[model samples]
Target: MNLKQFWQNFGEAAVYYPQLAQKMGGVSAAILYQILGRWLNQSSTVQCSLKEITDATGLSEAEQKLAREELKARSVLEFKLMRSQPEIYSYTLNFEQLEQLILNDSAVEKTSTVKRDPYFPPRRQPIAVSVTPHYQFSGPWRSQQQLEAFQDALLSYAKQQGYSNPGGWVFKIIDGISKGIKSPFWDEFIAEKPLGSSQKIQQEWEIEPGVPYPAFESERIQYYTHKGEPLESAVAKARSELRNPVKAKDLWEGFLRKCDRIANDALKAKKAGVETPYLPPSFSEQSTVTKASVMEKLSQLQGDSSLLEAENPPEKTLSEEEETSSDIPSLESLNNLYQSPITQNWVEEQIAKHPEWGYTIREGKVIDQYPF
Candidate 1:
């Protein structure tokens, strides 16, 4: 059927039949007319199924059935289900009855002679047109509980970071997630820092009295690495010293001087072929030393029992060690060690040494040890 021609005809008919237009002033009526109009240009009768109506109108099965029944009651359409296949139905457009109803409505409208102002024109009744319905899923993709939990986590994080308004950000994040957008940052942020605790320290440095401002990024990074402090702690320390501007300036100068001294000591140690306990200022500093020097230090540490003992001593006694061991590698190292035969043997030996612990390995990794 030519939909454009059918739509033009339908509009003209509505003008000629104001009552018919008024009767079709609802979504269901408009939908029914659209469906019937599609078949009218081709033939009076068309065979179809409920699914076809749903696909064409984007209405649910229940909505389509209700609309079909409404049209049937108004004597504008007729349909009968096939006896053999209940799903299939034959529809007939009752154009004769529709014309008759339109004429009757027009006659009734002409009989009502309502007076109008000379300057005011009569307003025509608006006809409802059916466009494609846009369906929005009401519930979230995830469960309500899970969504709420994530929102709470975001809110807590915002509060910790001193956000003036967190609801707006939380709403956007939740809305994005509802639309199937993944939030990996949310997962990582929640894992690294607890909800109520700030992950990054808030820092304010002072160039003048009572005029505190944020520290430079380079200075903040240097302070965090050199002091072996978390970003949040380093920032807090700097902020605390800002109350007294002169004292704060002195403290910063002292910190810079300490870094210079440490750097000089490390340089002298390198010349004397002595390994310094202090870490390099940055990875770039390590590159300044020869590869052979770095490897030689590693080789020496591997051979020297004293250094190894200082880092990780052998378990003294079961009474003292119990389930924990000073010699046990970190969780990160154990994860890597899980794939090694040597590490596996070492783990088995340790388990044998402490039979009371009832150590076990599952999926090629120790399962009985407490995971930190």
Candidate 2:
């Protein structure tokens, strides 16, 4: 790549390291770009000694050392020595890999904090009722006298069991019954009476997050928050510092640097006949190639026969009038002319606007303008 292209690509790579950009400033960033870019251009891969980097940058010996250390600290480049000479060092960072690394790191940091208030707010009572309604009797008919007798038996049972309130007594009784015993064992035991053993019942219930217990009173409830929410929301909410959020940017950059490391390692692994440590990044055709460019490529490779074959009938030729009247369109024409349900309404509207054409609807269908 030319110096301009190198800078652009290098800039893409440097995006993985936010702190490095800040540390190097614009001028130093340009220099680092030259140093790394030159190394990549000279060798099939980038791996260089200190002197080679200096030679590439045209910086002094002292300046070369400083640059090496700075790049290493910022993880812009990694160092390796094939021989003792300063220029004998070999290794380079892949900018694309680094960019993805930064993205992943930022993703991780953002997804890791708790943000919601734990305290429960007061519950609003229904305005029309003026009182909390209880579950009314909805079962088979029972006379008022039968209901009164049942209530008395329940109340006496509660007093015998030393439960101060009916709610507590009912709670225990229901708990025992649900646990598979026909009688309330806790009440009988508390009352100093012995009853036959009952089978142990195991009931499994799943509590949905934030749902209050039906049998329990009070507004307070326990709930589980998604683990990723706390850090993710916190990182998003925190304001940028130093004209931008340097820490977040740095993490992102560091991630990119790691990506570069992975990419470079992959190249080395290919050379060494070892497996690459990571799968490299991929882009969709829509993302990397424009529609115009794609069409241009297809046009260059096109043949008249191939084009003819793509049409509905491969073997037939059109008559002069048929060819002249042919409304068949190219891919581009199809894309441009694509219409949806909304377009139907729009066309009807236009026809309605023209006084010469009277459009009417019969039932659900348009009554006029049938061309086919």
Candidate 3:
């Protein structure tokens, strides 16, 4: 019994597809593949939602779309949209295609020649939306009308109960109080806030963050936040400090120094540079020289002018070790290629420039950008 060589595929609980990962040249496609494998275990055809797939794979909505395309192009899987409302879809794996892919590559591939992946992001925890314990529907919702009626009932409950800010969670409160009863003893009862609720992206803001704060302003807030200040408070304080020239100057210097330090580790990436998994603070990938870092460096700077670079330091480029692979395009690489102001013509230009990307994929394929 070759224990290490054997795979316990029957009871595989976590996400991975090593051979498929190698073939896909990245993890997103491999993750989607494993998720599909799990669904197929139940039946020949399995139907599920995009959210289910996204939750399992931990890939963003954008990355999930790309993963499906990669699997399709590789001829390893088929995905079809089953329904629209609430988004139901099904995937079928082509086991024969997968077998051939592994067999052919395994037959001739030398251990020395096969490249190793530099970094693999850990699986992000699924943010499952679970109903709180002791919570159930207010009434039997056998028909769509009953569900609609619940809304009117909720408004009446709110008015009768004098609820001020419960417009968002009326259903949550109603469900908990009703406990699946055909009729509750009272029309309205106080509902405790659901446990494990996600924090609002922005709390009731007392200061202007301009929706997305300016880069330097954001860094200033993050620095304070890291030090345990509330986000809204941080914004107010950051704005006030930035208004002072002396504080702002000190912060900019500190920002430059901080960025220089981070860039060194990121640019010399182990495999494709940006040593850290996911995004990094490199000029080639993303600039750490944003307004926020600058503000943080200057506003709260101590005696540290000697160690930092000049007013504007040279941008760090990716090293030989971090250069992007020149095979079938990875989604991340394609995304980097298709930067902001992504129009159809701009996408086409990038495609023409990188002909290899077009070999397996159509020009401008799956490069979804806003407004185009």
Error of 1 at 98 (Å): 1.0
Candidate 2 structure quality by residue, lDDT tens digits, 192-237: 4542223222212113322212211010111111233454343333
Q: What is the lDDT of residue 208 in candidate 2?
A: 34
Question: For residues 1-372, what per-residue lDDT tens digits would candidate 3 score against the true structure?
Answer: 676546664344465868668886578888888777776765556777888876666678889888889889989878788766548877888878988988888877765585656697456678989779985354545555756666666666566657775575566655654575433323322122322122223322213422322555667877888899998898799878776656766886786677676665556664575445433322233344665465335423433331122223346566632442332344544443344342334334545555544322345354433323
Q: What is the lDDT of residue 93 in candidate 1?
A: 81
Q: TM-score per candidate, in order?
A: 0.25, 0.21, 0.25
Per-prediction tally of clashes: 1, 18, 14
Computed on alpha carbons, the lDDT of every model, listed in order, comes to 0.61, 0.46, 0.59
lDDT of 1 by residue, 41-74 (tens): 5679888787876666667877777777777877
Worst 10 residues of 3 by lDDT: 188-197
| Top-lDDT structure, candidate number | 1
Over 4 Å off in model 3, which ranges?
1-13, 84-86, 110-372
Ranking by TM-score: 3, 1, 2
Please list the residue runs of candidate 1 whose C-alpha ends up more than 4 Å from where it truly belongs after superposition: 1-21, 114-372
